[model samples]
Target: MNIEEYRLYCLSKKGVTESIPFSKLPNVLVFKVKGKMFTATDINTFDSFSIKCEPETIEELRLQYDALEEPPYFSKKHWSRVVVDGSISDKILYEWLDISYRLVVAKLTKKERLELEHL
Candidate 1:
């Protein structure tokens, strides 16, 4: 998928926000919910986007898809860097992204979830 499509999809979720929060890399954009990060990528190139993933399934994912890899900057067991190549369809990407988003949302404190509900 294109950068705009990815951005829109992430923003479409409730209480999600995007920002360039990296100090050294000003063009890297991060998507967060309840102040916790879920995804991030290079704003200009869109070469790759990362998401929090279940540690148990990360190994299977990396093996199943050549494009799915451990991000250099994230915990290898809990985050994946999905290369924005045409090999993986947009539909599949969106589904995985939704899963990642929910995983992060699920980890939020009860009060944080209630706060997100009001957003």
Candidate 2:
């Protein structure tokens, strides 16, 4: 999918807020919920999107998908860069995004989760 489609899908998630956390990179869009980031990518050039992932599952994910790779900017153990090439199915990308969102939410404190629920 293209950048607009991807952006819309990411924003559609409940309590998700889009922001550019760094003033130096205004084109980068960080998607977060309850102040915790789940995914992020450059809006100006939709080359890839990085998602927070389970450390144990990263290797398997890299082997399973040709379009996924280690992100240059994120910790290799906790994030995977998913290329926007047409080779990967859009459904799979969305699924991964959902997984990332859930993973971040799962780490939140009970009070944070309760706050997120109301958002």
RMSD to truth, every model = 0.9, 1.1
| Residue lDDT tens for model 1, 24-102 | 9899999999789999999889999999999999999899999999899999988999999889999989998998899
Summarize candidate 2's per-residue lDDT along 1-119 as a digit string, tens digits.
88888889988988899999989988989999888999999988899999988898899989989889999988999999999988889888899999999999999999988987887
How far does residue 2 in candidate 2 sit from its true spot (Å)? Answer: 1.4
The reply for model 1, stretches above 4 Å from the true place, is: none
Sequence-dependent TM-score of model 1: 0.96
Worst 10 residues of 2 by lDDT: 110-119
Model 2, residue 24: what's the lDDT?
A: 90
